[model samples]
Target: MQRSKLVSQILEKKNYLCVGLDTDTEKLPAHLKNKPDGIFEFNKRIIDATLEHCVSYKINTAFYESMGTKGWEIMQETFNYIPDSHFKIADAKRGDIGNTSHQYAIAFYETLKADAVTVAPYMGEDSIKPFLSYKDKWAIVLGLTSNAGSKDFQQLILSDTGKPLYETVLETVAKWGNIDNTMFVTGATKADFFEDIRSVVPEHFLLVPGVGAQGGSLSEVSKKGANKDIGLLINASRAIIYASGGEDFDLAASEAAKEICNEMKGYIV
Candidate 1:
């Protein structure tokens, strides 16, 4: 999807929620566990139920990859079910050298047909540049992630730069691709630092996780991170998708998503 079109969708919907499809087979409803295509069936319902409340869908590849070939097939089927009007993201977090990275890009962008794929920037420019080369597609590099382990390296203060490594990352990576094709995975748990991060890459979009189940504040992230175009994709996974374990799971998910959308409407510019 083009950057302009994504922005248009956000404005048109009055929200920027991105539902995370981190479906776990073991955690699926009891009835679905016995089905031949349980995972895909669960995903189809979640997508259908929440479609009206979100402008994007992010599929965490690990969940699908775990089931092996059948899982991969289910992942592709779920991707196909998502409407093109909303941005599709494959949360693969893949990063490697030039040739290897090119194949990863092809797997997500060409094979899976995702509009964006999360990437790790620890390997530096070459590992990330290939994804940026694709027009209208995005390379979502990890900046300040929400994981507890992020403090181990991402927040380290480098002697040479005298700044948290993540700040340098935000500044350096922003130069590799324009605001149109580049986005940073700035965790919602780091809302306090959004103002500082925004100073580094004000125009680039930020894929924010941790808002719901992780206890990150939506209003705080919006107040500090949003630009004139509302450059944020706040994702809620377990909190929405697993809102219920019974037959009403789809309705529960829809209600959870709608609640978030309502909060987002107040924050949208």
Candidate 2:
């Protein structure tokens, strides 16, 4: 999906909510725990229930990968079930040497056909350049993440530039790919820094993942992070996906998604 189309969807739906599909069998309702395709079944219902309220769906590849081959099959099935109008994301956090990155790019871009994939930029330009080569696909680079350990590296001041590691990353990588194909992951927990991060890369979109279960404030994030295009994809996973542990899980998920979407609508331009 082109960036314009994504923007349009957000505006048309009055929401920029991205539902995270971090499906885990252990967390599945007891009724589905013994089902043959529990993961896919859970995802299908979540998609069906919340598709109208959300503009995107993010599938954390690790959850599926841990289940091995069967997990992969279900992941593909879940991917196929999502409507084409909604953006599909593979939260793979893949980054490696150029050659390996090329295969990773093909896996998510060609094989799984995800609209975007989260990428770790620690490997430098070569690790990310391959993913940018594809058309209408995005590389969502890790930036000021909400994790407690982000301060270890991303917050360190550069020796010469006097800017934080993430600031330098935003400046350097923005040159390699334009707004349409490149985006940064700025955790909603870092709401205060949104203004600072936006100062460096004001126009590019941000995939924010620290809301709901992580306690990231939506109002603060939107107030400081939004741009002329309202370039923010706020993701909520556990809070929405596991909103209930009973048979009404899908209904609960939909309700939770609607609550966030309604909140997001107020921030929409």
Candidate 3:
């Protein structure tokens, strides 16, 4: 989907919520465990239930990849099942040498047809450029993440520039692609850094994880991270999808998602 369409969806729905489909069979309700295609079934219900309240869905490939071929098939089916109006994301942090990155790009962009894919930028421009070559697709680069380990490298000050590595990453990468095509992954846990981050890439969208289950504050993120276009896709996974362990999992999931969406609406102009 084009960036304009995504912005319109956010405005029209009065939401910037991205539901993470990190479906785990072991954690699924016991009732669904015995059912055939439980993974897809759970995802279908989650999609159907929360579609109205969310603007995007992020599928973390690891959950599906662990299940092997069956998981891969369900992942494709779930991707296809999502409505075109809602943005679909492949939360596969893929980045490698240029040639390998090319195949990875084709796998997610062409074969699976995801609107966006999470990419690790450790390999530099060659690894990232291949994904950017595709039209209307996005490479959500890992910037300052929410993980505790981010302190090891991303927060380190650069030798010459003296700015943090993550800050440099945002400044340097912003020149490679315009805001419409390239986005940065700034974890919600790093809410305090949003001010500095905005100073660099003020217009580009940010895919923010670490909310909900991770205990990141929504209001803090909205205040620090939002741009004039409401440029933030706040994602919630275990908090919403696994809201309940009973048969009413879908309903509970929808309720959890709606609550976040409502909170998000307050952030929107």
Worst 10 residues of 1 by lDDT: 260-269
Q: For every model shown, what is its TM-score relative to the native structure?
A: 0.99, 0.99, 0.99
How many residue pairs clash in model 3? Answer: 0
Q: Give the TM-score of candidate 1.
A: 0.99
Report the lDDT tens digits of candidate 1 across residue range 1-269. Answer: 99999999999999899999999998899999989998899999999999999999999999998999999999999989999999999999999998999999999999999999999999999999999999899999999999899999999999998999999999999998999999999999989999899999989999999998898999899999999999999999999999999989999999999999999988874
Which residue pairs in candidate 2 collide? none
Candidate 3 lDDT over residue span 161-191, tens digit each: 9899999889888888888789999999989
Tell me the tens digit of each residue's lDDT in model 2 across 1-269.
Answer: 89999998888888989999999889999999999977788999999999999999999999998999999999888888998999999999999999999999999989999999999989999999999998999999998999889899999999999999999999999999999999999999999999999999999999999998888999999999999888999999999999999999999999999999888878875
Better of 1 and 3 by lDDT: 1
Candidate 1 pairs with clashing backbones: none
Residue ranges of candidate 2 with Cα displaced over 4 Å: none
Candidate 3 residue 165 Cα shift, in angstroms, is 0.7
State the local distance difference test value for candidate 1.
Answer: 0.95
lDDT agreement with native, every candidate = 0.95, 0.94, 0.93
